[model samples]
Target: MYADDTVLTVADKEIEIVGRNTHLLFEQTKQYCTANDLVLNENKTIQIIFSTRDHTTTQNITLPGLENKSETKYLGITIDSKLTWKPHIDTLCKKLSSSTYVVRRMMQKGGLDTAKIAYFAL
Candidate 1:
């Protein structure tokens, strides 16, 4: 029933109803956890409302304690409410740059094949 991350979805013309259903599901989940001698970690939990329409209007699921986030990293992939890939691309670029720096350092230390550097950059 659970994995490192999960994506739940419901369709409705009214966005609020979808939010409400999500809230109810969370409540039921909390109850199930309680009955099983487990606790839901509110601190690690967050909600994200996705919509192509007005972002402001999507904020209907207001649980008393949990915070909602515009972007979150789920199992290493960066996902935002707007579904933009900028964050993921930025992360990849950072790693690429760091790795390239390491390869350049290796080339400087010894006469490593220049072709290896080009290969690593790719």
Candidate 2:
């Protein structure tokens, strides 16, 4: 009925319990949505496991219809499964470089004041 971010996480010291509880929670969410007339959009849903485990270990738990991604962007931040900041920093650097080039071109053309260049940097 409505779209929103829904993240259900179940964690335990035991891997088996974690898998079982996560699956149970998924089932519960399905039941709840059915009772409430809400639909889970698979396209908007992504399953991300935040762990140090390798691909084989992480691949064990799967969300039925949704894709499993190493990284997902939310609110302009890139969040990776292993919690690395590389992607976000890379994005910021690229944007800053592009904006700097525009500002430099404008300055050379005498089209923008230094104050306006400072504003663009911001």
Candidate 3:
């Protein structure tokens, strides 16, 4: 009496699925179904297919307790996980600030000597 479907395309054929405590979730969902006198028919389930330009594959994936949590990956990068922008941004800012300080010091002393300028440019 419940169903959901999703479709996505990937440039590469590699795909991965991960679940946390999947066995426990499955047990809970099964118990709920039994208490409600609902019958789960595998034959009535819809299928999910993955295909690439060169190859094809299919799988039968079930939802957990009427809800599902999945992580998506494209070209090998996980899209569902939190992306940390602060650390990288802070590092880049520090590098740029350090370079600017050096440049300003050189300009204050006189124009940058050719060797220093070349080193900084490198």
C-alpha root-mean-square deviation, each candidate: 3.8, 2.8, 15.3
Candidate 1 residues 51-108, lDDT tens each?
6676456556656787878888888888887898988889889988987877777678
Local distance difference test, per candidate?
Answer: 0.73, 0.78, 0.44
- TM-scores for all candidates? 0.75, 0.77, 0.30
Tens-digit per-residue lDDT, 1-122, candidate 2:
85467778777766667777777898898888889989877688888877776646644477677788889888889988889999899889998898887777777776669637655566
Worst 10 residues of 1 by lDDT: 1-10
Show model 2 residue runs off by greater than 4 Å.
Answer: 114-122
Q: Residue pairs in steric clash, candidate 3?
A: none
Which residue pairs overlap in candidate 1's backbone? none
Model 3 residue 32 distance off true place after TM-score fit, in angstroms: 43
| Model 2 lDDT, full chain set | 0.78
Off by over 4 Å in 1: 1-10, 110-122
